[model samples]
Target: MPQQVQGVIARSKGAPVELVTVNVPDAGPGEAVVRILACGVCHTDLHYREGGIGDDYPYLLGHEAAGIVEQVGDDVRDLAPGDYVILNWRAVCGTCRACRRGRPWYCFNTFNATQKMTLEDGTELSPALGIGAFMDKTLVAAGQCTKVDERARPAAAGLLGCGVMAGLGAAINTGNVGRGDSVAVIGCGGVGSAAIAGARLAGASKIIAVDVDERKLAVARELGATDAINAREGDPVAQIQALTGGFGADVVIDAVGRPETWLQAFYGRDLAGTVVLVGVPTPEMTLELPLLDVFGRGGSLKSSWYGDCLPDRDFPMLIDLYLQGRLPLDAFVTEEIGIGDIEAAFDKMHAGDVLRSVVILDGPDSDSGSTNPLEAHEGEQVSA
Candidate 1:
């Protein structure tokens, strides 16, 4: 039988999301149904609600989530019921060309649940990034479920499902940040701070964090930034150059994803240093730089997608590190919120007030009212 559950849904573009009853199908071939424990409110979710992603209406929002597998499809082999897992958007198809070439991170074909979770009226809904986790439960491709240590806090561990993983991967995987290297991360948002943490985890001797907001810079400092530069106070490029002994940093990551920040990253590194662009930009955004600079730079300029992460390989390791106190994943969770607080959380995000406002699915002490209706007629009549 299809499960009726409460979920956050963006019924139309530029409208506020509502907690509605959704009909989630049982796991089909190669899929799994997960009982979401916690879901992080990310900027991307706001983007989807604002129609920044596409015309896909009735979007089931929220992606960064950690949960337990409740059921698995017949063809799913590696996962089973009761497994603690992080939901990942990219479930690399092993037979894809990228995987065949040993670059599973670049896998061209990713997987999502074949069936749609629908509005009670039987209207099909698009799951955000194929995870759609802002709910009591969600269904996803089996490969999207990466098992991690159960001891880790769900709020903290779930973050590795997206932004945190992207930042860490941008520094460690794409930028190839190494021990004793001088690293500069431009943008002190959740992603930027994670980059700084990644640099620290990778043993970078000098970690410089740049941002327009002083408060964010403070967070960056706590995350292992050796120096913080408020862009509003001075020229960040010049400051980074000065801090790196006039040679600039060994690696500079642009976490702001704008042309100005990209240029800052380009010039904020040594001649042969690497520049990694991990920030997301809108489709309408275009970047222009002097042709001479592109050729003049002797090193690489790269863009990181989902931090170039392979969930199966990186998630467990990160969870282990988090458990051992080697990585401060818990620091990223600035607050815990209820499902209905998503809009307010977005406000805090836009105001630069919090790193992450995680939705604790079932609060430790209380039983929030279930959004699901017991009867099919009740389910179908509730508008999303």
Candidate 2:
């Protein structure tokens, strides 16, 4: 039987998301149904609403989610009912060229659930990022469910599913930030701040943060930025160079994704330094950079897709670090809200008032029911 549940959906371009009834089908082959516990409101969701991602209207938003596996379909072995999991968009297909080369993170062909969740009238709703989760329950490919340490709270752990992972991976994976290296991150938003945290975790000697907003820069400092530069005050490129002892940072990350910020990142790094672009830009936006400069710069310019993260590998380790208090995941949660408060959360995000506004679906008043059947199962392997 199809389960009728409430979900947030952007029915049209530039339209407000409506909490409508979404009929989630039972788990089909290689699919699983997850009972959502918590989900974070991300900028990508807003982009979807604005028609920046695609023309996929009536998109079921909210992807940064943690949940419990309520049911698994045929051929699904690793995940069973009652497993706690973090939902990820990228589910690597092992036979893809990238995966065949032992680089699953770069898998060109990722997986989504074969089945679709529809509305009351049978209108097929496009799931945001292939894992629409702003509901009591969502259907997804079993591979999309990455099991993590249950001790890590749902609000913090779910962040690794999207923006946070992108930022952290931009530094640790794509940028190759190393010990004693100098690093700089542009735009001190959630993703940028996560990059700073990643650089700190990697033992970067000096971490610089550049942002137009002083408030975000302050947050970046708490996330381990050694220096802050207000881009509005002066030329950010020159300031970055000056802060890095007149050379430039070894790695520069542009989290704003605009052409101007891209150029700033290009000129703000030392020669032969890596520049990671982790920000999402619009379709109409074009980047104009001097071809001569591109050739003159001796380092790689890389764009991170979901932080180039392999959920099965990175999720467990990062969660362990968070549980040990080594990773301050809690710092990302600016507020907790109910499902109906997502519109207000979007407003807060637009006003730059919060790093993340998470929807708590496990509260007493939540419409979601407890589906975990393993609570009494002692010694259950919960990690990875």
Candidate 3:
């Protein structure tokens, strides 16, 4: 039987999302149905609502989610009902050229559930980033469900599905920050702060955080940034160079995807240093840099997509790190609110006042049933 549940839906371009009844089909081959426990409001969701990504209307928004597997299809061998999991957007298709070349993170053929979740009247809805988790439940490709430490709170663990993972991956995976390295992260939002935390985790000796907002800078410090620079106060490139003994950092990450910030990142690093662009940029944005400088700069300039993460490899390791108190995943959750507060959360996000406003679906008034069958099981191992 298809499950009827309440979900946040963007009915049209540039319109506010509404909570509507959606019908989720039972898991089919290579799919799994998850009961979402918590889902975070991310900037991407806002982008989708505004038609920045595409004309895919009636978008089922929200993707950064953590939940439990309620059911699995017949072909889903590794996962079963009752598994605690994080929903990942990229489910790598191993037969793609990128995957065949052993770079699954760059897999061109990622997948979502074959079946569609629809509006009550049978209008097919497009799930945001293929997860569409701002609901009581969501269906995804079985490979998109990455099991992690069950002890971690849903509010915290689910964040690894998106921005947090992107930030961490920017430092550890894309930037490749190393022990005794000097690293700089620009744009101290959830992604930038996570990059700082990742740098700390990777043993970066000097971690500089640059942001326009003082509040976000403070949060960056708490996330393990050794130094903070307000971009509004001075030239971030000059400040970063001055702090790094006149050479500049080994790796500079731009977490804000703007032409100006991209230019800042270009000039902010040392010769042969890596520049990691983790921020999403619009189509109209164009970067202009001197051809001489492009030739003179002797390092790799790369863009990080979803932090170049492989769900099977990165998610569980990060969760274990979180459980051991090394990674402050909990710090990402600024506040937890009910589903009705999503609009308010978006306002807060737009105002740059919060790291993450998570929708807690376990609340008393939630439309979801109180007792989750998945939560009843004490111990079950799902192979990664």
lDDT by residue (135-163, candidate 2, tens digit) is 99999999999999888889899999998
Q: Is candidate 1 or candidate 2 better by TM-score?
A: 1
Q: Scored by CA lDDT, what does every candidate get? A: 0.89, 0.88, 0.89
Q: How would you encode candidate 1's per-residue C-alpha lDDT over 272-300 as one tens digit per residue?
A: 89999999987888888888988888899
lDDT of 3 by residue, 221-332 (tens): 8789999988777899999999999999999999988898888888999999999999998899988788999889899899999999999999999999999999998888
Off by over 4 Å in 2: 365-384
Superposition TM-score, candidate 1 onto the true structure: 0.94
The TM-scores, one per candidate, come to 0.94, 0.94, 0.94
Residue-pair clashes per candidate, as listed? Answer: 0, 0, 0
State the RMSD for candidate 1: 7.9
Ranking by lDDT: 3, 1, 2
